[model samples]
Structure formats: structure tokens, C-alpha cells
Target: MPRIKTILMAGTALASVLVLTPSPAAAQSTTKPKAEEQQEAETSTAKADRETLLDTITISATMINEAVFDSLSATSYVGDKDLERIQANTPADIFKTTPGVGASMNGDDPATAINIRGLQQYGRVVVTLDGARQDYWRVGHGSGSFYIEPDLLKAVTVIRGPVSNAYGSGGIGGLVAFETKDAGDFLNADEQYAISEKIAYESNGEGFTTSTTAAIRPHQAFDIIGNVNWRDRDAYEDGHGDEVRWTGEEVTSGYGKATFRPAQGHEIKLGAIIQRYEDYVTGSSGSTSATLSRYDADTINNTYTAKYTYFDPDDRLLDYAFTAYHNKTKAEQTQVWPTSSIGNFRYYDVRTTGISGHNSSRFDWMGLAHTLTYGGDYYYLEGESSASHFGQGEAQAYGGFLQWMGHYSSWLELIAAIRYDGYHLDGETKGTTTTPPEDESLDGDQVSPRFTVGVTPFTGFQLFGGYSEGYRAPGLQDVFRGSGAHDTADGYIPNFGLKPEVAKSWEGGVNLKYDGILTESDILRGKFTGFYTKVYDYIETDFTITPRMTDNIGTARLQGVEAELIYDLGWGFINLTGALIDAELIDTDNPKYKGQPLENAPLDKFSATVGFRAFEDQLIFGGQYLAVGEVKRTQRSSGTNPGQVDGPAQYSDAFELVNLFANWIVSENLKIDLAVENLFDVAYTDPQSAWSYTSDVEQGKGRTFKIGVTTRFGG
Candidate 1:
């Protein structure tokens, strides 16, 4: 493709950035430079200082401690301040400002599913919490969803393309990693123990939240931290002043961690987390018409992990890490049907266990610097359903990879990596009508590869590109679960011969930084990316024959452009972000669906924010504007055999929103935050929502007021 050739040429001219320390001689020479040369010299000096600050912030998603601009991938980072500024209680709120990313809320459940570049569901976009994969899902009329509490998160990292094959399998859509706070994040250098308390309230939902955290360093080599949160809320009113039933919920969460250093170069950590949610939902379809049956649901998620690390800068081969973890999630629903004898029942359950380890070595050969990383991982999963009888299956998968990074010169860097994966499944249903499992087996394996090249032509600019491949094995549900119960595709059966999904992707991007561009303290950073991905053997529901099932769609393509900018104007900062995505079913077995736009693919999105600080940087204020273009979709058929619907009449309307927030540090130990969402009370429906197809669509939250207070006891 012409795009690929252009990116290759750019890569050959630019190189990767590895933040380096400023030279003492260069710093001293800045004072002696002439007036005409002084500005350029000072700019160079400031660039080094700013780059050092960025490098200190490590990104856990990539497993490398390099600056964000140094990689040949599209990435973004959100810190604690950003989270608080948005008053984000949901994943949609947290990612509202991010480009090329979309989130869908599962009705009144408060759980969320992620979409990246029009690909999602069935683990396509890998999500992790504290290095442990979150892989629980259920087939429903709405989008498949996952769970995670935001109150415990300290930071979030998002990689928006298949350029991250070395991270894991089935991440063709992208990766989202959440990191929890440690004692070090709360305590000052001289403080050994600390306690923080927080309380918050929101008017629209009549929601109240309380949180407490304690950190203690009992000894020089040992440290521990614990956190607990409780929240209660009532149903919230939408923009039309009508209460959205089943929106009320009660939640409780707990987290604990302990770290110990046994030697000068060895460290170990043990961690555990638990979350419980109690709510009453009026319907199973998550639709306004589902009030015929009410359900009282209890959801629980638990995880535990142990990790060890060893590092010695003097030894080239000693940087290593090992981890073992277990996670379980269960959702039980008690239904109150008008005529049912058994009023209570269990809904769904899933459990997972895994172990992984990796090591890296750095050395110099000839004139090039090389770093080699290799690791292996294995996981076992079991899923069960009580009342619905969706499926009962046991599955496992294992994989390993070897990656090498070489710095050939100051202007060129290269990366090559490959991974091998194998998976096996057992248990299957008897017939299309029956949901009972019978003995059945399936197995498959594949190898995926990645190659990347980065070029840096100057101190503040980088151009990079990469080509990578990704693979996704069919999940147990795709092969073992009988779909007869669903109304969409009647008499749906299971297909044991289903093939694995694969993707070939290409990406090219440029990052520019200018420190002291106009003034000594001014800084500007911008990044732009162009990406294209072609997925083969794409999975979709089939309705061709009597026994409807899942089969491979020939091919689908997704291409997009994303841009982000941040400018520091000495007194405040301005940020701008935008994305344009186009998705199409290029080649399918059914010619009628060819050239159709993929579901949930929004055409254009844009966001802008302006923020400033006052009172010696203790007080901050910000405002944001977000706009989204119309989404093209296939409408549901009115008949029992609703084969396929596509055209211009199936488009959803576009919408825009405005929000404002403020943060004030009253004192060294106390702070307050306030935010107003949907300031104009505009009625809008997210394109990804299940109810967006109807004229009487469910509206989003109206003008809402939120306030929070935090107090520190000791540090």
C-alpha cells in the first residue's frame, strides 16, 4: 500500500527516543552563548529537563520504562488528577476525552464494555487490573461487559492498536491496564505512616460515597496498605426529568497489599481485592419494557496475586519478574416472576487461574545496543450457568514469546517479536434445542509476529511505524453454548469447526515536542497516528440455515486517523483530541453484506479542554467540549427470520456535550472538588447503547452536580 511505503520512508529518517540526562558541559555552555544563539541553546536545555520528567513516569501496559513518545505505537496516559477532574464514576466518563476509544454501559448494571477502532467483545480488547487479566463475559442482547471499581485506581494506560503483540493474545483492538495505588503513592519521603479519608455526593442520583485508606511502614524492609469503600445511591433522573428505574445500587469494596524486600536486590508483593454489588433490576433485557419481571442480583468479584522481582543495574541479565494469580466472578439473580414457583435462582459464574514470568537482558554487540525479553504464561478457565443454561465448559491456553529491541544508531531503532499460542476446549451441548452439556473436545494453535522501526531526526521530534499480527482463539461460548434461547437468531446451534480470528495491522505516527518554544516555561507536545487493520475469518452470527450458528466472515477492514495535542502556556494548559474511523465488511460469503459499515463504528469524534491554576497552583478550573458524528448501523428486521438490514435509513443522530469542573486545595491536608455534567441539560443517547435504535431512546443523565472532599490525617 502507498501508506505503508510512506511510513517506511519516515521510519528510515527518524529514530526512537530514550530520554537521556543533560550533559554538564552543555548546561555550562548555555550561559556563554551569544544573544542570537542563547534562545536556541536554552530551548535545548529545557527540552532535556522536560524529557527527563516524562521518562520518570513509567507505563505498565508496555512493560518498558520509556517515554510515551519513544514507542512505535498509539498510547495515552491518565493520572489521578485527570480522573478526579472528570468526577468519573464509570468507564465512559473516564474515557470521554480520549480519542479513538468508546465505552458502552450495560444498561442499569453500571458495568462497561470497551470498543477500540470498531472491534470489541470476546477478549478482543484485553483489559487488566494490577497485571491480572479480567476475562469474564456473557452473551446477551446488549454488549458484553466487564467490571472494575474506579475508587481504587491510581492511574490508567491505554494502547490503541495491534502494535502491542508482545503484551498478550487477542488484543487486536487494543489494551487497557489499570494500576492501583501503593503506600509510596500516598506517603512523603520522611513519613512512614499515613491515613486518608474522603466523602462525596452527587445530586442527580442522590448518591453518597465514603472511603478510607491506611498505609503503614512497620519496618525498614516491609510496608503495607489497606483501603475500603462504601457507596449507596438511588435511581437517577434523565434529561427529560423521568426516573430511570433500576439505576439504584449499593456497593462495597476492599483492597490490601503487602510488600517485603528480603535482600538488597530482591522484592516480593502479595495483594488481594474484593468487590460486592447489590441491586434490583426491573428487567432482563435492560429495556424500559422489561418491567414485567423484577430481579434482585448480587455480584461478587475476588482476586489474589503474588509477585517477585529481582533487579541489579550492574548485571545485564538479572532484571526479572514472576507472578501467579487467581480471579473469580459470580452474578446470581433472584427473579420475581408473576407465576413462577421458584422465586430465586443462580445466574452465572466464572473462575480463572494463571501464572507468568519474564526476564530481560541488555548488552552491546559491535556498534548496536540490544535488549532481549522472553516469557511464558498459562491460564485455566471454567464457566457455569444455573437458570439460563447458557453453557458449562472448561478451557485452558498457554503461550510464550521472544522479543528483541536493537538500537543501531542515534537515528534508528528496530524491534522484532513473535508469540506462539495453543488452546483446548471440552464439553458441548447435545442439540440446538437442549442446553445440557455432553462430552466434546477441540484444540488449536497458531503463531503471531510483530516488527517495528522508529526514527528520531532531532531532539524533540520522532517518526515511527510498525507492522504486527494478532490472533484470537474461539472462546468456549462460541463453540459449546447453544443459542436457542435468544430471540434474535432463532434455533441457533453451536459450530465446533469455527476457526480462529486473525488480524494484520499497520501503523505510522509522528510525535513532536518543543520546550521553550515562545517563552522559557512554555512547552508543546503533539502526536498523530494513521492505522489500518484487516481481520480474516471474522466471527459473526449466521442465519442461513435451519440451525443458525456462528461462522467466519471472509474479511473486514478498519482504518482511522487520531491526533492529540497538549500545550503549556505558562499559566494554563490547552488539550485537543480528535479521531476519524471508517470500517467496512470488504469481502464476505454473503454479497448482500459487503461494503456495510461495521456495528457501533462512529464516524467522527472531537474533544477540547482548557484548564488553569490559581492560588499558587492550589486551585484549578477546567472546561471541556465533546462532539460525536452520526453512527451508521443495521436495523433489526420486523420478521422472525430477520436476515440482514443495511442502508442510509439506519443512521443514529449525532450529539454534543459540555462539562465544567473545579478543584481547590483549602490547605495542606484538605481538598475539595466540584463538577457539573451536561451543563445545558441536553438530551442525548450514546450510539453504542442498546436502546439507541428506537425513536423513544433512553436519554443520558441530565444537569448533575457533584462534590467531593478529601482529608489527610498523617503523612
Candidate 2:
């Protein structure tokens, strides 16, 4: 497809960067045929000035979300001083600093995955925020999205590996982009118009998170920004508060952005986003004990965006962009089933709806730079169950992709991409029949590929490597489930006949930046990486009862190595990270489960930190340790049916946390800050939850403590 003719020649050179920016007032009113050569240029113009800042600092991670770092893959960035000290809801703290990537949630929940070089979620990798294509979580009764609301963010970029045809076929496992917050960056450089606020607290649980931001910018062309976030929670005790694990929750979110440059590298942007949530649960997966089973779950979301860009006034030879988007996700859950004669009670309702549309593009050649992206997606799902034995489902599909990035300058880099997908289904169940639901239509096609290489050879040392191929597509109640007793697969898994799961990966690392590199004066930062991945098919969970879903198991392998070290210590900073993974399950044909050990794969994990600072940068003190090691469910070959064996193989755990924070400027505009989370009193459980063989292990979050304060009004 010549990559769609290289994005149609990058949209005709982005309309020649809008005809050279209106010719700068027609070159100063076409005058000066030599008025004494402008009096010798006014004596060399009182000196000199040469300027270039990549047209106001190259936005969108480099025009249209370019992904080709680490040579076609492995890209990770999380700015804003690490979002002012972690607790970043989703994007798992910036994809764990990228590099062969691997992430886990279920511990504070965020609905995320990217495991490249090790292949995860859908098999290869694909994540997007500004350009759409997101499941956000709802894939198999999980209904995720991690409660999305991180103060409307400002930065987060990830491009792990294997980006199938550039971005298609569920990305086969590579792509992440959540870049928001732009309204001329809230002006105020003597131009006036500004306001900002933040309130936060952490110490295991018991929550209060508040945020506000505003920017108006009278004119340097035009700018407007608004952001808001609020979260409230009560329920703790695994470390304190007595005993309440992961409880009660409420969240409200909103953001608006507008920017118009009229001329000068031209631009136009409009946006809107909203989210509302109410939650309460006591161990999902059909609760048992820990009461509070009076469940509550609701999510409402809306996003609308339109974007355009053009640039090139010597601005790196090229720049181009076009964007359009719409998003909607409505989720609901309420339950209290389990009774017989004594108080007879029953009620279970589940609902989901999604609608999506999106598009993307970018390029710069001759210096060797190319990027081409394409899009198309649609969905409609319906459900209502209370053991009525009825159903309805529909999901349409269309997809396309092409990616190419080659730098050939500044020490090598190369990347390649491919993608194509098609899905369809429509159905009914004869007016809630006693037993008559198994009608369907199916379709499919997939192709994903990737390759990358990044090398610096010297200077702070940089060396990278990558390989890719991935796929995932099997939803809609896992292809028409039916029958009864929680019908899983209910019968026919031929909803267009499943098939689309493949993964192959690789990873190599070496990077040691500099600017402080230890001692040289204090400010230091360090990173270390190691990886391994092997897999095939691997998509378990099945019981064929009627529609009891989850399939594609047979082969699997996952190896791991992780490390991290950092020190900013201008006054205080310290961090250390570690991980180890070794998974199994191969050629499972089921027979009680071939070779087991794949329930939530975890071998070892660790985290440590130390911090202190006073006055100067304000007060802050910290100590933390999160640990996990030894876990087994054994009997692999594509697990799930391991039963009888005396249960539990091994489990080791640890958690020690102590924290306190304060920031008191108290002058030149006043400021205040405070924080404390799980200062000790540990009780943890987040090995990525298999729910402990279905549903049981819930204990986590205790010693609760949280407080936040902020003040600022107009400026």
C-alpha cells in the first residue's frame, strides 16, 4: 500500500507548512530596495539573534505521536517531575520506565497492559489515548479503565514493541499515548491569566485527591485550558482503620482545552472529556464473606476532540497532523444474588456500551524520517441478566495500518509496521426463551509485524534491540455463550470462528545517562534492564457451559529481569526497583490442565525507597518497601483445571511503608502541602490477582492516612 502512499505524501507536505506562515507580513511590506541598504542595517541591528526551538518545542511527542525510539520500539517517558510523586492511577507509573516493558494492575487498579518483548494483552501491544482505539478494560468481566482521572495529565508516552502494521490487529502488543494538557501551557509569562491547585494524600488508603487548573492567555494568538479532578474514599484496615480492604469510592473528572494560533506554524484544537464514577465492592468474582456485598459500580465517559497541525519554517524540514475523535463508555453493575426461601432475594444487572472513531498521520524525509498511520473502529454491546436465560450482542469492525520510521542519523534507528482487521456479529434469543440462544455471524483477518534497533554506541552508553509480531480478538461474550448455570461458551465458539493470537519477542538493554551520573555534585539518575519472552496462542479461561468464556490456550513462556536506581537529591530523592518472572504452560489440550503455573504469573518483585528534605525545598520524608516472592499454582500446559493437589505451592510477601510530606512556601503567593500513607501496618495482595484461583484473596491496603491542602486564586 506504499503505506498509503506515505500518508498521501504526508498530506501534501502538510500543505507546505501553511504556505510559509503568511509570508511574515509579506517580508516586512515589500520595501527596502536598498535605502542606503537600510543605513547599513541599523548598525548590525544592535547585535544579533538566531532562533529555533523546534517551533515551540515539538508537541505530541514529536508531531502526530511518532513512535520509533530504541530503533522502531521501546519508548517511554513520564514527565512533570514524575507527576509530583507517583500515585498515577493508570499508565502504571509511566509504563515502568519502558524498555522491553511489563506492567501489572489489580493493585490500585488502572486497567493497563503492554508487556512487549514478553507479549501481553491481546498478544502484541497497542494503546492510545488522543487517537482512540482503547478497550480501557471490559474485556472478560473485568470492566477496567482504572478509574481514569489523573488530573487530566500532561505527559505519558510509550511505544514498547511489535506494533503490527504500525497500529492494527489489537497492536499485537505495543503502543501507548496519553498526552493531554495544552492551552498554551497556561500562559502567564507576563501575559497574565493563571490558576493552579492540587490536594493529595497517601498512606495505604483512605483517600482525598483534588486538582484544579486554569489558563486563559489573552493573546499571543489564543489559548484556554481547564482541568478538574476529585476522588473520595473511605474504608481501610489491613494496616489500620481496623479492617476494611479497598473500599468505598467516588470520582468526578472534567477537562476542556482550546488553542488557536491563527497563523505562525498554524494550529487549531478543541477538546472535552468527562468521567463520573461510584464504586463499592468486597472482592469481585461473585463475592463471598467480607460482607459489603451490597455492590455498586457505575462509569460514564465522553470525549470529543478535533486537532490539526502544520509546520516547517526551517522547523526540522517537516511537520503535519490531522485528528478527529469521539468516545463513549457506559458501564453499570449492581448485585445481591444468593438466597433460597429464607428471605428470597435476587438481582443482577450488567451493561456495557462503546462507540469509537479516530484517525492519525506524520512525516519528514531526506534526513530519513517517515511515519504513516491509519484507522477505523466500531462497537455496540448489550446485556441484561438475572438468570433469565436471554441475550443480545453486536460488534462491527474495520481496521488498517502502516508504519515506517528510519532516522539513519545520530547513530542509527529503524522501525517497521503493519496491520489489518475485520470483525462482525449480530444476534437474538427469542423473547427470553427457556433455552434458545445460539445464533451468530463471524469474520476475521489479522497481520502484525515489527522490528527495531537503537544504538548510541558511546556517551552515557545506549544500546537497544527488539523484535515483534502479535494479535487478540475474541470478545462479544467470547463468541455467543449460552445454555445455563452461568453458561460459558454456552456452546458455539464459532462466532465467526475464533483465531487470532500469536506472539514472538526479544529484548536487549544498556543505558546509563549522565548529567550527574553519581557524586559529580549530587543530582544522579540510573537505570538497568534485562528481558525474555516466549509464547504461542496463550489465551486461557474456558468452561463451555453455555457461554462460559475465554479460549486459545496451548503454549506459553515468560522470562524476566528488572532493575532500577535513581537519585535526584537536590535535597531529597531515592528509588530502587526490582522484579523477576518465570512463567509456564505449554501445548495445553486440557485434561485437568497440561502443565499449569500460569494463573497470575509472579516469581519475585521488590521496591525500596528513601527520602528526606526540609526547608529549602520544603519538608518531605519517606521510606517504603514492597515485596513479593514465591508463588505457585503448578500443573501447566495451558492451565485452569488444576484441581486437587492440596492447593497452594508457595507464597512469600512483604510490605513496609512510612511516609510524611510537607511543602510550605508561605510567601510570594503562599503554598501548602501535606501527605502520609500507610506509615506502617502492612497487609498487601496484588500479585496481579487471579483472584486467588477464581475468587478469594482480597486483603490489601491498610494503615490508612491522607490529607491535602492547596490555595491560589486568580492571577
Candidate that would win on TM-score: 1
- Per-residue CA lDDT of model 1 for 319-378, tens digit only, reads 888888888888887876535524866577878888878898999998899999889888
| Local distance difference test scores for all models | 0.74, 0.50
| Model 2 Cα lDDT, one tens digit per residue, 1-715 | 2332233244334323332223332345434568756753642341111011001222221124431222223345565434444545445545443434545544322344545544455324555555544444343322243335656876656554343324334554456666677866545467457777878765555567888877887887888888888877655455433444345567788778888989888788888778776764323432344432333556666666777776654555345555666556555545443332223223323233333323334456688765554444444434334433223365555555555556666767666555566666565433343665446666676665656676776554457666666556665455454432323223323334456566666766554443323322233333444545555766654542223445675777766654444444345665655545566666767644556566545435455566666664455556555444545554221124322323345443433345444445565444665545455656565444433334343455555455555655555
Candidate 2's C-alpha runs over 4 A off are 1-123, 127-170, 173-177, 184-192, 203-216, 220-684, 689-699, 703-712
Q: Report the number of clashing residue pairs per model.
A: 4, 45
Candidate 1: misplaced stretches above 4 Å? 1-56, 60-62, 282-286, 290-293, 337-344, 387-389, 431-437, 484-490, 636-639, 647-649, 695-697
Residue pairs clashing in model 1 are: 14-455, 14-456, 15-455, 15-456
Q: What is the alpha-carbon lDDT of model 1 when measured against the actual structure?
A: 0.74
lDDT of 2: 0.50
